[model samples]
Target: MAEALVDLLAKVRERSRGLLLRLEGRYTVVGDLHGDYATLQRVLNEWPPPYLFLGDYVDRGDKGLEVVEEVFRLLLEGKAAVLRGNHESPAMNVDGGFLDELCEKLGRGCGAVYKEFEKTFAALPLAAVVNGKVVALHGGIPLGENMRPAPLNRLATLEGDLTIPGDPLAFQILWNDPCNCDDYLPSPRGPGAWLFGREITKTFHALHNTRVVVRGHTYVSAGCATHHGGSVVTVFSSTAGPYRKTKPKIAVVSDGVEVFDLYTKSRAACPEDVDLLL
Candidate 1:
């Protein structure tokens, strides 16, 4: 496992360095990783470049520290931009009693690792701009004046107090989802909307004057799901299985502000995976 992680990190560094230098345009957005290192590795290897990870780098799997470290390296190399998913927040994890468990899993004498984790988490961007379209955080539409994606852009600039709630942009960026969907409802059991229905998505797009919004927070059987007049798309990188599944989906972005998916293997349901990475 350690060797594999080392190799993955090395590959991420190399690929990210090259990709950052040459690629420009909208970013290929990936869903929550949840510490599934192998799945993340496979996607990175198959299609890398001009990508962004939509938070949840730790928890639900082993190697959370390694995941953050390698992701931090990617940020440094400029290969990708990261968003602060709900799971990345220490306060949220602490309230849920997962912080102590995670600390135990990480073992004692891991202060440096913990500090580094906090630092990297602090540095994640709260939202992204694909062309003129605004993709603001976790789930549900932003509430009040606090929910706008403009301030969330500061997430890319912050390196301290990543978990504090003083900055409206801080928490809202990872917690807000588009609220105009009908078919998909926000998960009653999770943070933010279980699913932002299609209705909410259409309204949001109309209000924002953008064609699409991208997000990740819930699990979708098909690896990717869309709603709101196809205005909002959710991409799930982790497959459903006791361990892992085979059909991993990735998004690729073009220079023209278009996003589509790059499937691991040919699947019958979708003739071809559309690029939805922007």
Candidate 2:
């Protein structure tokens, strides 16, 4: 198992970039799975490829290893694109459950495997641009009065190297959260991250010429939620559990974006406010 993990980690390193671009075509974007293997499998069965996963595949649930294995298998088979979430960092493993799960499943001497997985996490992309219109990532965009997003073209070549980014922009790309305010505000998540508002989202779209930003991190009651006037969408695929009350959802991107609940298997209309905004 450890040998296979090492090989998989190497494959992830060889294939992933910091940012992926020109992902043109119909695709399903999945949110944080948090080790809910059954729900992850259900989402995959319901949504056809090509698929993009917004990370947090492991941790917090009973089947972290199973979820990770399935996602990595798909990734290795060229069936999906996986981005890194904040939880992917080694620093987060203790609290996130991946580390403990590994110890339990692989025994105490699995340090090397754990380290290899960390490298794999570092190699995962930070974000992806689909059809040149929608941007998908794990967290939110960075915020600052004078801050402008890095060019999308350049971002495509960014690479991860097994360490959390120290660059403010890169850090925020993995940690920031969207807000309803008119400008950037301190994030309750921490000191470095900030909550950005709709105006910022608008500016980002204008700068990038993109229509929408899709991300995952926070759980929403409706399985998915549109913020920043529909310029930003958050999808959460983890099933209704002790951590959250909402059902899980995945975003389908074709002619337009549609969200489907994993449990109910029902398509949900975009909120009326989002309709007007978009």
Candidate 3:
């Protein structure tokens, strides 16, 4: 298992980038797991492969180690694409559940391995483009003047091992949230993160020539939410632990974006049903 993990780490370093583009085929995009292994498995079973996971695989849950191992195993098998969430970064994981989970599961000697995972996290792409029509990421794009988004190309070649006190760009990509207001505002999520409004979402799609942006960071009660007239969708797949009240969701991209509610085992057609709420 350790050897496989080491190999997976190396492969992710070489093959992964700060941004990726998917040009064809229907894809299933999942949201934050936060160490809910059972829910993760169920979602995978329901959605099948060609899956893109929107990070937060660890931390603040009891099954962090199990979830990480399973996700890595699937990744190695070419069954899924994993993006780094805020919880995957050293800044968040070092003090969150991931490190503690590692120490407890692999013993005190797990420090070196933990460092390797951090490196892997650093290499994970901040965003993905699907068929040039959608952009999927863990967090929303940064807000610029006139509610414009920072260019999608700016994140294309991002490098380096990101610590919390590290790259501001990466920090924003991993932490920002969406809002219903008309323009950008300071996020209650804290400094360095912005609560982006619908206009920003619209401008981002116009700038990138993409019609949709799929991301996960905030918790949505319906398990999924669409913003900016369906230009932005946030899907959350973790139902256990901290998200007991939230029904997990996954987004399916075929003719158009469709959100599946895992808890109710049904499809949500209206974006209003998936509104972003605290």
Candidate 4:
């Protein structure tokens, strides 16, 4: 298992992926799982990848480790890609209960497993661009100079493992949330994170040369929510732990975007139930 993890890490790093993972094809954009393995498995049984998982794989739920393993398995198989959510860092794992779960499950042997996961997490791309139109990320964009939204291409590349959320751009990309205002606002999540507005989303799309922003960070009761007049889509695909009340969903993106109601066994049975998206 250890050897396989090392090999997977090598394969992931060996790729020429920079800040964005560029792909041209249809994909199922999943939201934060937070270790909800059952929902993840069920969704996979139905939806056909390629899947773009918007991070937050570990922590919170009961099967974070299993979730990570399964996601990586799909990734290695070339069926999926993953983004780095706020919880992917060590600081988050400690607070979000993944560390406790790891210790309890693996006893003293969890350290090496965690080290590999940490390294794997660091190599994860912060965002993914689908068909050069829709942008999927764990969080939103970062604030540029003058505290404005930065150009997506002008961002600096990381030369080391991001064991922690120390880098400003990386931090925001993994922690920031969207809102309904006209500019950036302070986020209750923390000092590093911010709640951006509609224009900010528009500005980000303009600067990044993308039309839509699909991200996962906050909880939405419907399992999906749209901000910035549908420029931002937040999908929350979890029905475990503290998120039992939320309905889990995924964004199936091709020429356009459609929200698949995961609770339904057959997507065709309820075609009209799909949420509105541009």
* Model 1 C-alpha lDDT per residue in residues 1-278, reported as the tens digit of each score: 33443444444434432101222366666776766677667666876565678777776656555566667667656777766677776665555333554567556644444444454455445565555565534544443343223322244444435444445445544565534435344344444323334554555566656666666765554566655545666666765232265244555444222334445344324222232221
Query: Which ranges of candidate 3 are over 4 A from the true structure?
Result: 1-3, 144-147, 269-278
lDDT of 4 by residue, 170-267 (tens): 88888888776778888878778888887788788888677888888877767877777777777889887999887788888765566777877333
Residue 187, candidate 1: how far off, in angstroms? 7.3
Clashes of each: 26, 0, 1, 0
Q: What would you estimate as the lDDT of candidate 3? A: 0.76
- Per-residue CA lDDT of model 3 for 1-278, tens digit only, reads 56666677787778764455554668788889888888888877776788888989898788987887787777778787777888887778877778888888777568888888887877777777777887888888865444468886766655664655366667777788777776687877777788778777777778888888789998876677777677778888887677888767888875357787776668975344243533
Candidates 1 and 3 compared by TM-score, better number: 3
What residue runs in model 1 are displaced by over 4 Å at the alpha carbon? 1-26, 92-107, 134-136, 145-169, 177-200, 240-246, 255-278
Error of 1 at 125 (Å): 0.9
Scored against the true structure, residue 89 in model 1 reaches a CA lDDT of 64
2 versus 4: better lDDT goes to? 4
Candidate 2 on 153-269: residue-level lDDT in tens? 655455544366665666788888777677677788776787777778888889888898888887665667888777888888886344467677889875356788776768865
Better of 1 and 2 by TM-score: 2
Against the true structure, candidate 4 has what lDDT? 0.78
User: How many Å off is the CA of 181 in candidate 3?
Assistant: 1.1
- Candidates in order have lDDT scores of 0.53, 0.76, 0.76, 0.78
Clashing residue pairs for model 4: none
Off by over 4 Å in 2: 154-162, 269-278
